[model samples]
Target: MTTIDKAPTVQSQRAGTGTRGTRILGTLTIVSMVWLIAFGLGFSPADRDQQEAVRIMYVHVPTIWIAYLAFVVTAVASGFYLFKKSLGWDRLAGASAEVGTVFVALTLIVGALWGRLTWGVFWQWDARLTTTALLFVTYVGYLAVRRLGGTHEQRARRSAVIGLLAVLLIPLVHWSVRLWRSLHQEATVLDPDGDIDMDGLMLFSLFVGVIAFTLFYVWLMLHRTRVMAMEDMMEDRGLDEALASRRREAAMPDSEEN
Candidate 1:
């Protein structure tokens, strides 16, 4: 028998292949994250001076890096969407921005915790922190803008512009410590002399954190993009049904009432 509930079932099946890939990647991400945390906590060497407090860098630095990476993907996707007027590009930008916002919040929270342990405060108006905060707020606003009601093209065009413009803060956040004297320390991994000023274990653990978080972000973006596509598909189905109903009504002859 025919069923009224078949449309979404078909949509879900269409997404099955990609979802399976995401599931496999998500499993690998979980395993890598566990290894990263274990190595950071137990194997990584403590700093010469910071002692136990240094471990936070494994999470703090990597999360902030991923946040930057996410937004950069969003900006590039936005640019491509603008150039091509493609829905695929718009979906990619939206997915990246959503994941980026979560990572930015994590960066702030972890940074605050690390600061309390090392800098003797949970919050500060340091240049890097302030700029990072601004970046977070900007992307949050970008996500909110996406939720505003509009036609697909209208929403995509507006969000693509926002995605491009919001990422301008990334460089400012990255170089804020260098640009202005602040309590935040300068870049460690990107030293001017190309010398990494850290123990081998610490560096290795940092690398692991970066890889793990980046994989997690990719898994998240895949899932988010799929969900967004499904939403759009459902909306399209609803519009199609509404238009077909209107057409049927228009085609009906007026009742033979004098």
Candidate 2:
């Protein structure tokens, strides 16, 4: 009797950036967000001055905080990339910058809504607003610099420089209210005098917002960095294939002449 050859089973890989850790993190993020919504909207009492409009602070504050954190991470990672000449650090810097840009936009939008309610105008020439807008624009330019065409090293070097320089705006933006006579309120949670201006429950809700957003940031960074890595791999592979194709074509002309 003739034995038939057995076909080997090929394991199929799942597509997408998620992993077991990210899934667990995503679950935690979702749960924390639900709690944040409950505490921020339902449980926390309205501000005596701003009334229901104070609810926006729960989102507005955390978003700006995360944006600042993301920029700092980008600056640190960019520094490491410059020192170590490592692509991993470069990928991290790019991912963080992208995520930070989104958070900055969110912060501006939420702040505008809060401003409209409290300051009686959606837009203002306040120092805090101007500096925040400048911060957002600077990062947007940093991202554009990253996309400028060149080798990976070229892209990383230029972008890293911009990343390092762009973070200088954060301190200026943070202190703009203090440094100038402005309509923007001083920091309540991070009061310079160490006095907590918010109620107990309100403070707790703000903390919850911070925690939820931080978790979300980690989850997003995980997915984004993985995606960036995959993109680089694809780009390198395509370049190699194109070079091989060129070699084959160059040899074909000689073979045809022969």
Candidate 3:
């Protein structure tokens, strides 16, 4: 396992940070989530074409947005770890990737629901859908690699490299609709021509959903990182105890006489 001399310090610092900020963010995220649900489910007018199905967009789009953000953060952290060889960066990268996997999985589920409703099919091999699925699987593989048995540095280095390489798929996923004739629509709010093709209320609801999910990701990352740090500390203590026992045995006199 990768060892950090300051694992205890890192854990304590994160606990302190999580105390005040997590509470505030958690509360605010709940508030935003409530408003988003109300706006998406009741206030926002249904789409002329898809009607009730369009509401899924509020959930589906924001989740993918947050998932993308999570992967980007992971990649950046991994890059820093490579450059500075900081265990903290490696832990952050791993934590972010795990959270990103959850969000991306949710993204795929919600997207499938939306597709079934809007397109009369649960899935399609379109450019955007395929690339998004690929992105999800890639990060999932990254997480799996992190769990493999190895020294902390070995696992961290391998996972960090995978994390950075996986981000290359992000652009492909984002621009897949444009790059090919995908059933998925190209950017609506982020249209290159600076046009939003949705109602004002719907747009606001989408924004709230984005903020809520983003805050949720932040909370998840903080909690998950703390958990990883504690695990690392436990692993370190186990190794120390085992080594001490070995040293004690070596110091003991041989009992064989005769």
lDDT of 2 by residue, 183-249 (tens): 5445432211122577899899999999999999999988888777767766767688789889999
lDDT of each: 0.78, 0.81, 0.78
**lDDT, residue 79, candidate 3:** 95
Candidate 1: C-alpha lDDT = 0.78
Off by over 4 Å in 1: 1-18, 168-196, 239-258
Instruction: Judging by TM-score against the true structure, name the best candidate.
Output: 2
Worst 10 residues of 1 by lDDT: 1-10
Global fold similarity of model 2 (TM-score): 0.80
How much does each candidate deviate from the true structure in C-alpha RMSD? 7.4, 9.2, 6.6
Q: After superposition, how far is residue 205 of candidate 2 from its true place, in Å?
A: 0.4
Off by over 4 Å in 3: 1-18, 169-196, 239-258
Best by lDDT: 2
**TM-score per candidate:** 0.79, 0.80, 0.79
Query: Candidate 2 overall Cα lDDT vs. reference?
Result: 0.81
lDDT of 2 at 114: 77
Rank candidates, TM-score, best first: 2, 1, 3
Q: Score residue 177 of candidate 3 by CA lDDT.
A: 49
